[model samples]
Target: MASPPPHALIIPYPAQGHVIPLMELAHAMVDRGFIVTFVNSEFNHARVVAAMSPSSSPGNNGVGGLDRIRLVAVPDGMEPGEDRNNLVRLTILMTEFMAPAVEELIHRSGEEDGEEKITCMVTDYNVGTWAVDVARRTGIRSAAVWPASAAVMATLLSFNKLIEDDIIDAEHGSAMGKETFKLSPEMPEMQSAHLAWNCVGDHDQQATLFKYLVKGVLAVDQCEFFICNSFHAAEPGAFSLFPKLLPIGPLLTGERGGDKAVGHLWQPEDAECISWLDAQPEPGSVVYVAFGSFTMFDRRQFQELALGLELCGRPFLWVVRPDIGYGKVHDYPDGFLDRVVGESGGTGRGKLVSWAPQQRVLAHPSVGCFVSHCGWNSTMEGVRNGVPFLAWPYFADQFVNQVYISDVWKVGLKAVKDEEAGVITKEHIADRVEVLMGDAGIRERVEELKKAAHESIQDGGSSHGNFDKFVEAMKQA
Candidate 1:
């Protein structure tokens, strides 16, 4: 038999945003004739399969075309029914739990009677370190896939320097929440406030997470290659900072042409959000709001945001996960939802749901603006769809992403914060929303950015060409 095309193993951290991009990359590899095996945590496998069954119609037919792509679930060191408190703890578990499982999988996959001898492995940057010893033991090549913008990666690479300069530290009195510090000069016009807040905590747990992040990057440097889910033209200055990083994305572009064939790692409920948008009078007339899969706001912040949206007097689709904050069903300001619906004249102008189809919503003609947490995936999706943003970044490099969205691209506007408390007020939210959606000059600038984002991913475009080159490299390797 002709030697089975080089077998490759693809592993992604289990969260929603992380899983989706890795799935896209795996699909790309499969299309290029690689024998791919996608590994997931045992807990996540159950969730994904449950989400994929036909009964789960809204889900992307979980594992539909995955026949060629073997699915493997390894233990993540958590006992069944572990709490999974929050993003921070879960991330640490991902690193600590993944190493042995990956090593075991490699050995099993390379057996003489196995489906194929593993030749290469690709994993997310967060989990890349776990694959290092495994790849070395199995004599297979490995690459790190950074699912964020190059700017974020550049900031991460400079963490050691930030620590050394005494700008941030693990000491009890370290300069964390202070406004005086600034990001390294090496970073592109970024401020200290934009750094991932987790990196600044004084506690050991937080400090350890930063240490682990640094170690992960160093381990990635030892890998054969590095990949980022970004287009060259979108952040040329940032891309140039990393000599080994490859910008190969806008991966959601193909799906933009109204193709429903693209797989959704998280199957969303098909609510009437789209139908509501369809009834709107003009294209690009609605505001789309979602704070990704893991963000949460305090009750006061949530109430203010609700008031702001109502004050804007615009049609909107909002996703509010049940467990968004403090692990309880969020209670919006009393009578707030009723008032917004009343103001819209009951044409279903505001569709609030636990979750909605995000990519589809962004691509819809009625979505003129996006209010987002500035997570990298959501940011790319908004840019690709040509929708401007109202940035309300939560933790992580989301703050830096806001700088890119507002200061660099000038397509989006930031919410004004209280000068003393730094909390964004509802009035500030309302004012910025009006400026982005109503001002002629602001609209024109946003449209121009839309054009640039589109050009960056077209054929012969920076992202497209890089994708082609990436496949060629994988094949040659």
Candidate 2:
């Protein structure tokens, strides 16, 4: 008799950044003959279903031309009208609520909608390890997926080490006034104050995040594998410093060989931007600026960013997501849109979209530089396309990712915020864009990383081998 096909239930923390990459991982699993049940928050499930190509069905939500994958959602312990953008509310609810919801789903798995017995589980660390414990109770194998760069996870896993080394205060997790330090000699140098949890929010929020980290570290020993969406070739030092982390990523869902487009939380609303990009004659002349979904700006900073793109002069494709603070409907400074991005998101030197097909945008030949928030997904996309960056880090791991891109990788330059104004002004934005696009060396270095990224995902590369080993080991369990 043949064995039952492995059914893996995959869940990500409830965020667009988290969902997209994990969806890519599920796609890969289906290719490897696993029956993947991808889980999302009720809100995210609707958004992802709406964004999928060929139109996703509520009854069957497989995406990207894969038949073995299914999409499911569980309540995130929130009211239907509650604001999920509130991090504190989200953290409290998910911590107190998500485990039970997921447990219920597992308990009912064999009873409905052609569902098979869940043989394994994969979940993000931010969603808490309670789900992992539940998997163990159900006698299913489990793994934790770190959605950030391996180095970011290194910083998280090194909290006690930081205390032991006297780099941060044990009580508050604040930096002990040291200017800079390294986790190990091999790891990249990081500012003591820029510890992963420190830069997230205020002291209370930081403490909440810190609590999660401590719990995750303690519970990680039970999981069979702790993998990350990072490439070993990109962060050898981080990998060496934390050998437990296996790198199996740079998962570009926009595969080179014409795979169907992947689902996005926000649908790509502007096709003209790509046409605008193609019209640029130079090999790499267009500036592509996009901050991922969670970045918010006050009215002043929002105006500054708009005017900065206007001042940058070079042709640019900017994805201005509708909810970048100041409400869903925001107005730029007077005459700003008229002067740069004219009617139909074109006719002028710049074009703006509510959302973009990011991987496709980065892969365009005319796109020379990425003005980014340094979200790990953005970081991976930029590296995969060999686009040098003008880093505008907002918060959290973004600052550390900036250090890696500008200081360690030498393929980008960080935008300097005005000490008095506390934002990167239009003049500074123009200056950085010019410098980043003109640097031949930065361009060359990123091309090297881009090559490594593609190689790592191909047959026999480090990521390929690591993934193969993981899948084989999971099959046994």
Which prediction has the highest TM-score against the true structure?
Answer: 2
lDDT of 2: 0.82
Error of 1 at 294 (Å): 1.3
List where candidate 2 sits over 4 angstroms from the true fold: 64-67, 112-114, 253-263, 324-330
lDDT tens digits, residue span 156-201, model 2: 7888888888888787788886778988888888997777788877
C-alpha RMSD for every candidate = 3.7, 2.0
User: What is candidate 2's TM-score against the reference?
Assistant: 0.95
Reference-based TM-score, model 1: 0.88
User: Model 2, 358: alpha-carbon shift in Å?
Assistant: 0.3
What's the lDDT for residue 416 in model 2? 92
Which residue pairs overlap in candidate 1's backbone?
none
> Residue 81 in model 1: shift from native, Å?
4.1
Top of the candidates by lDDT: 2
Error of 2 at 160 (Å): 1.2
